[model samples]
Target: MPGFAAHSWSACGYSVQKVYEWLLGSQQRVTWQPFVWNRLSLPKHNFLAWLFGKKRCLTQDRLIKFGVITDGIYYLCGAQQETQAHLFFDCCYSQRCAHLLQHWLGVYWQGDCVYWVIKWRCKSLCKKMIVMAAISGLLYCIWEARNKCKANMVMKRPEAVIEHVQAAIRWRLQRSDFVQQKDSTIAWIRDKRLS
Candidate 1:
């Protein structure tokens, strides 16, 4: 009873926050958190990005490991195994979509797209938020396209996916009053026709 009392009162008092923290332990910061949870990004997009950052998406490779399916071929390109890395970074189909978005945004970086956004050194926080939202939107759209292909045996063109992401980003930007109303930001939004 003494040992139980000591353990229970270790935090001095029982509160939901303390209990929650105690159960979860120390939080490990991740590089992708800022990009994935940007205020400019949609909630669903953030959720998908979080899953992707965690490598928790049910990619074909994981599905195979789980015995959900035997084949691990990527539905997008059909030339590589569908892994979290392959589906998001290495697959030709996804690469094309990423390249198109990168070109449109005029933001270039090497390695994982999420990390690139995180490390981007733009002076404007607004610009960085826009980029993060767009990138998160791209990841969400790519996964959506993959799901469609899997369910209907049809694949959407990279252009179509890019268009969807652009529209979504544009919509979010238009509705966001938090965007910095600087001349450069305005000009950029006008140039991209995202306003």
Candidate 2:
């Protein structure tokens, strides 16, 4: 075999896993995976975040590509073409919601909120999970509000969305078992008024 090497051939013969890896090359871990799939997050929130990470959410730009809609204006802001980046990061509505949530959580993220959440440093993993859950909830709510606006339903105000996310986070924390939580983690929950 012209392209084959001795090391490439295993004595036990080829396996599906080996073939898959060879075909796909080395798998690089996504930075947003942990942020999207945090155990403390709700299922819907996790799903929405995963869609966001994959850029699979049906923003108006994608709809235009599909010819389902001719116009691509963002329903939330109505000031620019609707795009994954614009809707999630650049839109004033989303930025305001994110700002309020970040302020409430006493954290500031400059860019790519999901990446920021993954790299955020804190003494407690529990606190980190709480933050991840909150961010996930915020993303989900923003998408919901956008859809509502597109459908001509009453869209929630950014402050209202933040309040809803905060209440959801607090409710989730209340149901979580805290028996083995560290003192710092409990204190964080208390300080955030999530307990």
Question: Each prediction's TM-score against the native?
Answer: 0.88, 0.81
**1-195, model 1: which lDDT tens digit per residue?**
564375686557657776677668799988888987799899999999999889899998898999999999888888988899998978888889898888888888778888878888989898899889989999999999999999999999988998898888878877788875554864685467321
Instruction: Count backbone overlaps in model 2.
Output: 0
Candidate 2 — which residues are off by over 4 angstroms?
1-26, 178-187, 190-195
Candidate 2 residue-wise lDDT, 1-195, digit = tens: 521354365565767876676768788888899998787788999999999999999988899999999999887888999998998878999999888888888878899888888888977778889889999999899998998888886878998888888777767776777424455655565566322
Model 1: residue 2 alpha-carbon error in angstroms: 8.3
lDDT scores in order: 0.85, 0.82
- Model 1 sits at a Cα RMSD from the real structure of 2.8
Flag clash pairs in model 2. Answer: none
**Model 2 lDDT-worst window of ten:** 1-10
Error of 1 at 141 (Å): 0.9
Residue 10's lDDT in candidate 1: 54
Best by TM-score: 1
Best by lDDT: 1
